[model samples]
Target: MQVSEFHLTAYSTALFSTWIFIEELGLLFDAGDGLSAGLLQKARKVKYVFVSHADRDHLAGLLQFQQLNGRADGPLIHYPADSGSFPALEAFSQRFDPHIRGEAWRGIRSGDALPIRDRITVDALRNDHITAPVEWAKSLSYRVWHKKWKLRREYLDLPGSEIKDLIAQRGRAAVSEEVATLMVGYSGDTPVEDYGRWDGAKLLIHEATFVRKEDQDRARNNRHSSLEEVLRMAAEIKIDQLVLSHFSSRYSAEEIDTTIRRYGREFRVTCPVYRLLPGQIHRDVLREEPVWSL
Candidate 1:
């Protein structure tokens, strides 16, 4: 599936709440405040939810979300393995919503892959947001991959009839191989590092909490990325579309847009770049006019 085909809705403001919903996949990244209120009926359609960290701003909405959509069969919630907060929340949710049984709470770590669809998988990657011990898993990013098939190199040049015959004789697996394309990458509140991890994705949704290096002091604990850092990373990567979120409330829309344009020019970034303004719930984020369009 194409990343462009998904309808992405998001509301992200640093320290308040941050969430992104992919309507097509029924997938959600982070369940921050107003998640249930913002998504409303669409919240029920979510079959998979991934929480990046235990930060209150990242998971405060899970209570309302679970109250509305928790079931005994689906809508699994995934979180960092070493985060005790998720288990506590799950327990509280169980007690608060005694009738909901289908909600499965799972803890995952870096390199874990969970299939959300028959051919689509979400893989977790450790991020540098949390400063826990080496063995502790507290923060993560995710990448979505779509399975595709192609004729094996050895059979690529074969005639149609020959390929058909081979397929008939040896089965499809023998004639073709399965390939996966990185459809989307979501950097949930992470500093811009390891550009290779997100490169080549069709869509990259990352955080730009600070627009300037001087404003880094605004974050007291977890490290955050600056707009300049993100732009520099974007310039060096091979992403098709970029969606930036989790901007601090200190900056106005005009200032954020202007900075994005400035960095786009400085970095010679050609990809369309979209940003979620503070306190606003962006609907069909990719469909909206990008702040810096080539």
Candidate 2:
């Protein structure tokens, strides 16, 4: 379970669990190895379960997840109504036991908000530029806000019911005064345009698929962001810390470091940045980690 400043805590029990928070509630983002009985045991605390995208890497844990969780009775499973080849609803039904198939699944578009609690709401934004059919590829960027407090936090969710609300209500998603901090933004396999128009994201968990200049066009064609684009987005959004992740297995850590430095020099932003690799660990993960500078 690799945890970083950008992503919420991830638990590697019988199943793989990675999540992000809207308020205090746990929003399960990716549940890998859904068949692992341990996966459900670990996810007992999840209030909202979201399948970020429909790609096999993103949806790999759904079967085990449905097995352990046993349907919509526990946490609400939100996903996109139509995910390229695999319509989210049909996939859920096919993957899970028939008993759990129709559990509380909500379909979402862009610009909609899903209420996690009385005080917290998750708002969704669209990434129109990315054309990948994977759920994470067509990722739904989010803004989590505390209604009473007026504080806003941003994250990324795949197209689901929660996201539909966020897309439906654009511009109205503002943070309240009571919100003390804003955390990082998740780029679940997003493209360059996904980071555009971001105003005040403190941290960015973006993907750096290719490091070499020769591979730049390939990365762009795949709708994955390059190291250069990550830096540019951070500089433009003024993120406090940027954690580049989802690297192709091809690159070594040293190679990634060289690429980051190369792009960092070009962008010249003061934000601290890091890269996330497999098997990394962090303690006391929160779905909604604070983003305010202490």
* Candidate maximizing TM-score: 1
160-262, model 1: which lDDT tens digit per residue?
9999999899999999999988999999988887999987889999999998778886555659999999989999989999999999999999999999999
**Candidate 2 weakest lDDT stretch, 10 residues:** 11-20
170-202: candidate 2 lDDT, tens digit per residue: 633532235423343555556667444454555
lDDT of each: 0.91, 0.54
Q: Give the lDDT of residue 27 in candidate 1.
A: 90
Question: Against the true structure, what is each candidate's TM-score?
Answer: 0.96, 0.67
- Deviating ranges (above 4 Å) for candidate 1: 217-222
lDDT of 2: 0.54
Number of the top-ranking candidate, with lDDT as the measure:
1
- Model 1 TM-score? 0.96
How far does residue 26 in candidate 1 sit from its true spot (Å)? Answer: 0.6
